[model samples]
Target: MSEFETTGPERAGPERRPRVCVVGSGWRFTGGLSHYTCRLAGALADRSEVSALLMRRLLPRALYPGRARVGVKTAALDYDERVDVFDGVDWYWLPSLFGALRRLRRNRPDTVVFQWWTGTVAHTYLVLAAAARARGARVVVEFHEVQDTGEIRIPFVAAYTRRVLGALLRRSDAFLVHSEHDRQLLGDLFDLSGRPVTVVPHGPFDHYAVTHRPSPDGVFRLLFFGLIRPYKGLDVLIDAFHRLAPEEVSSFHLTVVGETWEGCTEPIEKIEASPYRDRITLVNRYVSDEEAKAHFAEADALVLPYRRSSASGPLHIAMSNGLPVVLSAVGGLVEAVGEYAGAVLVEPEDVPGLADGLRKARAAAGTRYPDPHTWQRNVEAILGRSAAAAEGGTR
Candidate 1:
């Protein structure tokens, strides 16, 4: 046998790797948080002793493999292994908060990472952070969407989220945000001076660089991929598509991928039954990874006309696949979708603005897409700083 074939796989030389535990809501499939967790775990696995504690409701066997080798301890609420994203991370299913606390205390991780977004895991995070702190473990809280616009009409839930998040933030050792806007929001909302904050841009997927078969014809295909929520501004996209001339409409197509949430389907159904039906394609369901790739492959550009302000994972996915984006200037969308040659920014919730953006995006189609290097560099900087801190180094 060749030397490569004869030798066992090369092992990372041991230097007392720091134990790191990642806590998150769910990790079943290809949503934003799941993708972020998987990527972060993979990146840290190469250098540190990494494990993940996922919620039982979202555990998938397929999603997590090689857990035994990687020391993944999955904690779920049930006995089912129906949800798994990838392998190589340890898992503990249906584990109580107290059980998780005991495990953390026993493992004595060097750092405990928490991923927060919808506030579902808020109480658990607070308890875990306290547990980790008692053991001298550094706590890192990564805010997927921390900015509270204070525009939420639901006062009770908003108030509860604010109170819980404030407590979580105050207890965390370090805060990781996706944009400067989020950093500023953190500073405004909580006492964050003592706990340093770092900005890390979302990274592109590995498959983004894969060779994709282009759409057979040169029709300008506009794609809206992700969960169909009211805030996504689908109404604006529909209005913009409707305003196109007959010939223009015939020459273009809009594909709405992913299912509707938050009563967004009513308007979508109205659009589907209207005169502009033929100009649009509604693949209204949770898009699989393969399906998403095919849609991106067949599209000329991705349109993200969100009404409310927040960062977007779809924008990063689109840009990573070399699909230029036309996005509304709201919250961190502008920061994430920088003014690259392939990006077009427009006013939020303006039908005419979206229409004009569409025109410009179509006009700019076939141009070189934005470089992913910036995202890579930003992620590296964040991880580097985190690693340095873990190793007793300065920022």
Candidate 2:
């Protein structure tokens, strides 16, 4: 209610529903951020007055790898017409900031939900959030990750990124996190002893699910999904694939799906060049939704032995397809794997442990996500009167 509130009928009667503006990576046809923006915005539109302000490029061409633009070229806007989309935020252009801000001022949404994941877009978001706060709109930051999960080899670069994320968190009025680990991390990183941070689980990626299919021949297929990054432990998984017993290695085919970013696939390619080359299939590109669905449908299990992560969408995607997951015990993964019926959790980078987990996959059952996280509950926790009960969830 700072400076953005209009006193009378402007805030009531015909437009009684809460006006929500979601600004983030839009229409990414194959990735997590785009998937999240589309799903959450569509759900919000059902109960609230919602519109999405999406960025055309998350990073410059030089910065992004394996793709020309961030999103896919689909005929429909944001994969659905129900959710209103303003699909023109070019991060490279400074003028785009003013345009987005002008739209915010003219439209004046009650809540401006800015998606925060990487520190690269911090400066732009900081200015935008400040303007929204000045205009009296409550700014709710949905943190996918407090810091970028992409492996940063440079020490100085990593340090600066953390500082930028801390600044952005300070600017936001309330926070919407997906897990308790993220909620605790937010409190420890900033001075939020009793802040309004609602912990809403990520909705099931049920949209990605397809009818299950048996593996090719007799070989068990293991899928290591998502972008190739150092932190995701792809190298470790590849090494484990080679180190497996001859009979064990012969029993399975590893499907390494996803694009290699910033020239990070050398190690994976090296492993593929080894004798295990015949056993591992490296798909180095962004996959279409239909392609992704087919991969999940046939795969025996999804392995994500991440070095670090706040929460996981790939895990949810696997569960949605009723696929058993074999992930490392790190971040919110401990809590996430527990919700699934037949997931195998091992120590991060534990090569032998991961290898053994893969061997155990033959006996694993297709998991059941009995209670999927609903978007209705997520939006309500952010805007309804029950929001007060979701607060004070801090260390």
Candidate 3:
């Protein structure tokens, strides 16, 4: 029998849900995109017949920044049981790629949603996009960033990406972005004159907030979490911490928890040389969900001083926990957290402004129940009729 010939028990609904295939990084690679892939698949399952085709191996071990833990089981998140998942395609393995193509045909999805972050998967995406289109499926590419900072630094890679992404975007039927800022960047970089582009808010990463507990210590704890890369502006955060008055510094403690990436060591060096080093705790490694939960639980506020970003996973984690956040206003981050009651936006790279924001965050430190973002709204915006009918190409 053909794969599509087999039918499961009928679900109670007004009509049969559309079948969807979500393509993204798998848990084997274990990063923000992997988490987002799983979460999105699970959410889509609530309203669609969902299948996930994940990238198991993105690149060669030597070239990967997180090579040491490439295949390690570091994530606690998994896909919904209702969603069919293929653990996935590899960058260099032709057999794995063939298997993914076969899976796509077997699933016969109505729409294939591709997660765009790095150029490493462009070839694979182009191949899969063609396969999906051949099967009469609409293709939707969700833009995570215009171009990866690390990838943009390499001239050849940048050139290759420009050609490949241009082709892929031309073939795509629709586009999804996290914010209007991202929509503008997409328009500026590519020609989307008649394409349907919808702005969807990032869903809450609240699954880890079950471990929330207030700090027993009297000190007001501040956290700066996520990968420590050059673009993350960790050095500016260090400088902001130092600018705090002696009395204010005495009342606060800063925790820097993240895996070092792209050899960005200046922030760590600054931390080691600081006069108030005793007040800072640094966990310079990628941590498990349980460990991350513990970090959020003991913290009074979360601070992310990014020089540039489309969106942030850590910021969503803070919002889910209702933890007060002090974020640098840049890129899509400003609109992403602007409405949150506990958010204090400061100018990017402004050390004094960050210091002021930190003070404000400390003064307003307390849990605010009910996170604003939801997966249901995100799902609706991506597949709903309004998204298809959006005006002037993007909404």
Q: Give per-residue CA lDDT, model 3, range 1-395, as digits (tens).
A: 11111122321235777788899999877989999989999998887899999999998878999888888888988889999999899999678998898899898887789999999999989999998887878788988887899999999999999889988998888788888889988988999867767877788898877555666776789999999999999999999999998888998999999999889999999999999999999999999888888898888899999999999999999999888899998998887876688889999999999999999987886656467787876576555534433322245
Predicted structure with the largest TM-score when compared to the true one:
3
Q: How good is model 3 by TM-score?
A: 0.94
User: What residue runs in model 2 are displaced by over 4 Å at the alpha carbon?
Assistant: 1-15, 28-30, 67-79, 150-164, 365-371, 388-395
Candidate numbers, best lDDT first, in rank order: 3, 2, 1
RMSD of 1: 9.2
Q: Judge candidate 3 at residue 345 and give its lDDT.
A: 93
Q: By TM-score, rank the candidates, best first.
A: 3, 2, 1
Residue 316 of model 3, lDDT score:
92
* Residue 137 lDDT, candidate 3, scale 0-100: 80
lDDT of 2 by residue, 1-395 (tens): 32222232345235487777887775542358777877888877777777777776566656666556445553122445765677656667567766787788776777778887766666667777788778777778888888775534567767887776667667676778877888888778788545467776677677876787886587788999888877788888887787787777787888988877766876567665878788888887777767778788878889998898877777888877777788899987776656566688889999999888887776674444453456665666655535434322322
